[model samples]
Target: MKYNEIKNYLNGKFVSGMGEKYDVYAPINGEIIGEFKAATKAQLDEVVAKAKAAQESWAGLTAKSRSKVIYKYRELLMKYREELSVVNCEENGKSMEEAYAGVDKAIELTEFACSIPQLISGKTQDVSKGVNCKEERRPLGVVASITPFNFPVMVPHWTVPNAIALGNAIILKPSELTPISAMKMAELWEEAGLPEGIFNVVNGGKEIVEGICDNKDIVAVSFVGSTPVAEIVHKRGSANSKRVLALGGAKNHIVVMPDANKDAGSRDIISSAFGMSGQRCMAVSVMIGVGSIDEVYGEVVAKAKNMVPGVDLPPVISEAAIKKIEDYLDYAQENGAEIVVDGRKVKTDEGYFIGPSIIDWGNSKKMSSEEIFGPVLEIRSANTIAEAAAIQNESPYGNAAAIFTQNGRFVDEAIREFQAGMLGVNIGVPVPREPFSFGGIKDSKFGYGDITGVSSIDFWTNLIKITTKWNPEHKVDWMS
Candidate 1:
């Protein structure tokens, strides 16, 4: 299907700015689907100014009123869910099933953000010395978000709607690779009668991004990408004193103990290892298990083999991603890691596809330290549960780690020892609900605030405490 030419969705309209428009190819078969404008610094400045203008009024509205607009947008999203899902799948190269879920999850995020009127309400505290003290959360005026390509819809949903619902005008910089879906979301907001400039979608690379981050009008910047790029953005944005939340790359792990249920662990491993083609920041790229569980490890390999590769999963984000996966596979093999399963030959005419592969990288140095964002996993065998836990702790990335076990003591011990920002006992990916915020630790995530749900409103806005007193008997008017 041919998609429309998407330019900058700026200030209530779509306009082609001064930049090269690149053709978006269908990853499966390398077909040119449509053209998208690469934004320039000028376009970004204009958008941010508009956002700042819009945010003034948006923030003036009550939290309930602002949330109503987001709620209406959520309804419109459901009404056109199928159309959006198709667009997501065709452009993103994910299987139809995964695309459907991504759309659904985005809708859920919008709805969740819409239900936070009470959560954003200011609080009051009783203080002595004849003073009434109160503190209230206020909108940060204008904010910016830079989302990754893996889950274009879901990642931004994790940022934008919450910011808008909490009364902050938002500027979103979606990945040029799959920017159409975000533009579609902008249209839905307009249809929901949202004020112009309250939400703007700018499509571009670094020039536009830096312009937005450095702009004084934009108060905060949220980003998700590789560790190196995230660090750069975080460093630069924070240098200007902008509130920045930059989510970096992760080498998440799933540890298995000898006492763990082998069947269940294998299932969780398969799902977490290959879900979304392992393009998610939360996907388990490494598996640390006790060496005594060799039979269970074999079971994991056999499960990976049964996965139909290209037919069952979406392709990696780009051709470069495919090359990275291939290079890592070869590199791991060359470094003495045993390839228990190889999905390199998987074929799909429509997208860049790779199936599922498992590598026993126990003997290979640095194999367990890398984050391969594809349908590949490295299994590291440890002599004991302590060794497995140590392997999980030694990784530089502490975004998330999962342990599978039935023992309460083991679960509690692992919980206390794992250095990850997020942990899952039996679950694979423990991305939290709207009430709980999502973030990572170490090099995985930057900044001091959470990006979504209630914390989003908290992060997008600052707090001010107010104190007042009225006493007629002791009225000493000091410019009262």
Candidate 2:
């Protein structure tokens, strides 16, 4: 499957778009690896119409039958894991290991969706005498997923499989920067014998997105992007009377108690801050050291300084990303923060790379609160555990927070008081497995549904209740 052959997958076939084609670049070497045609208005309309028509028969299928098709899709995904990883590495600027991990995560969600039969089961209870009520989940007519560029394949799978398996049609609008992976997944869906129009891929910028939002046929829209864009999507989609799940940005914080092991805590902190070049929403951006600021700071800076930029650490997504990170670096120094490990010294000619950086904000809460989205860690000191917890709770973004301590009481207190939607006791990135929901609170999320697990199923479907009563003797009284 060469990149040049990539086209919009519509109605179970590859269809050429009517608009101009744009070049797709490999982030690693800054070379044009392929090109994709932006879908036109007519093409988009046809795609939606086909999706609506195909969804009727798809929704008519039993859950058991749909699960079989999903199982086959998972099998194809596993068989093509290596090839998919290569594509992910080239376009996403992640290391080979991280690319493989992304594919593996996609596979995990696909496997989870295969259990839709059991997950979508209805419940029956007696509401009153001689009346029984049943609650069942049914798919929305048509749904659209707008994913970000960071985890291209995995994020789409976070929505696609669940929506389709539950009997809804899907229109996937992947990030223009990394649309190749979505095209590849569409090919795999065709190979798995999925019905035509059950899944469609549209590649474009804001026009396609606004079209999906305004289209009356699309019942729901799911989005993952920056907070500003997520808010706009949520507002526009909800204004159109559609269900929307818009997951936004985050500036996650990690707390290190005095009783925590310095070495272990540093390891977790380094991994969370630098992994994926700190582009992930759950990445730890702030470190709140309680009564152990000096010890934890020394340990974390020492380990981070030794990591090589492009070789040991992953590169940032694009040159623009690198410049954005550098701007943050310059701003921190200008604001009187002490630079511990500067990432500017680490440079590479082949790719957009930046080494891990640590900035000591020293009781000032200026740049420590923003989402840097790069491998720059800010250290903030707290006088006591209560103050540290307060600092974590006061942040407008309640995405993820972690507390490291050996004391059982402190761990318990942190778990209870932390305002984040996802909390970690010792783990740095405590994203739960496939069956659990993945999202944040406050400005970190806009809607009720998260991306993966049962939350995904719930988002793609609407609950329907049925109340039934049967009386054999009185059936023909009115007619007679």
lDDT (10s digit) by residue, model 2, range 307-353: 99777787788888889888999999999999899999987787778
Instruction: Give the local distance difference test score of model 1.
Output: 0.82
Model 1 residue-pair collision total: 5
CA deviation > 4 Å runs, candidate 2: 472-480
TM per candidate comes to: 0.95, 0.96
lDDT per residue (tens digit) for residues 1-480 in model 1: 387687677888877767877777767666788888687887788878878888889889998888878888989989998888888887788777888899888988888888878776677864644557898878888888999888877889998888888788888898888888888888898899989898888888888778877898888899998888889999999898899989899999887878778788787878888888899988998888765776668788887777775566777777888888888889888888888888786645556887788888774456746778889888887776677778888888878998888889888878888889889998788788767778889989888766776667768778888988754446344423
What ranges in model 1 sit over 4 Å off?
Answer: 347-350, 472-480
For candidate 1, the per-residue lDDT at 471 reads: 48
Using lDDT, give the best candidate's number: 2
